[model samples]
Target: MLIVRIPAEGIEDFRAYEDAVLPLLPEFNGRLERRLRNPDGTIEMHIISFASDADFENYRNDPRRITQVRLLEKSSAKLELLSMANVP
Candidate 1:
């Protein structure tokens, strides 16, 4: 299992980023399984769950996603992408 945290700044910022990202979502071949917005306004985090390393890699390598991320980075005061292994 793969986990990633995307800091979106706030709910509005998350929504705006989601709106832009939605268009390119299909190209990922359904790799990005779930995306949840943190309920509290503290971190403004986006929790993403991916199936495997290959899937994660595919999404990361997509030029469209890369461009989208670059654009989002400029929009937010802080954007952090943290990769982790799922443990349970």
Candidate 2:
């Protein structure tokens, strides 16, 4: 999962970054399960899954994604990634 906190002025840049990169998920066997936002619109949460660790690594290293993530650098957004497990 990715948790994002953006400055009010940076939300557009953050959304643009996500818009440009998210479409590449399928190329690396990734799935975006859900995207949630706070009522105040300053925080966003994305739940994504990949077929395997290799796939996740590949997606992270993909040139297309790398190029687009520059948009994130343009934004004043803080992003944190969490590795999650499903337990019974």
Candidate 3:
């Protein structure tokens, strides 16, 4: 999962950053499970799933993803990446 906090001022840029990167996920065997936005409009959360650790790593290291990350970093005040698993 990815948790992102951005000042209201950065929202526009963040949307642009998101649009550019989301298309790259399928190539790495990943998919966005959900996206949540705070009612107050101050934060966003993205839940992402991947076929395997190898797929996640491939997504992390992909050049296109790296470029999008740079844009994300520039637009957000805080960003976090978390690993999650579904319990049986």
Ordered list by TM-score, greatest first: 2, 3, 1
Model 3: residues with Cα > 4 Å off, grouped in runs: none
Candidate 1 per-residue lDDT, tens place, 1-88, comes to 2222444444455456657765564565443445544465434445565556676678778776666665455445355677766679
TM-score of each: 0.50, 0.94, 0.86
Candidate 1 residue-pair clash tally: 0
10 residues in a row with least lDDT, candidate 3:
68-77
Encode model 3's per-residue lDDT on 1-88: one tens digit a residue: 8888988887777888889888888998989999999986569899999999999899889888787776677776588889888999
Report how far off residue 2 is in candidate 3 (Å). Answer: 1.3
lDDT sort, best first: 2, 3, 1
Candidate 1: clashing pairs of residues? none
Expressed as tens digits, the lDDT of each residue in 2-79 for candidate 2 is: 999998888888889999889989999999999999987789999999999999999989998899787898888899
lDDT, candidate 1, residue 72?
53
lDDT of 1: 0.55
Which candidate leads the pack in TM-score? Answer: 2
Q: Positional deviation of 59 in candidate 3, in angstroms?
A: 1.1
Best by lDDT: 2
- Backbone clashes in model 3: 0
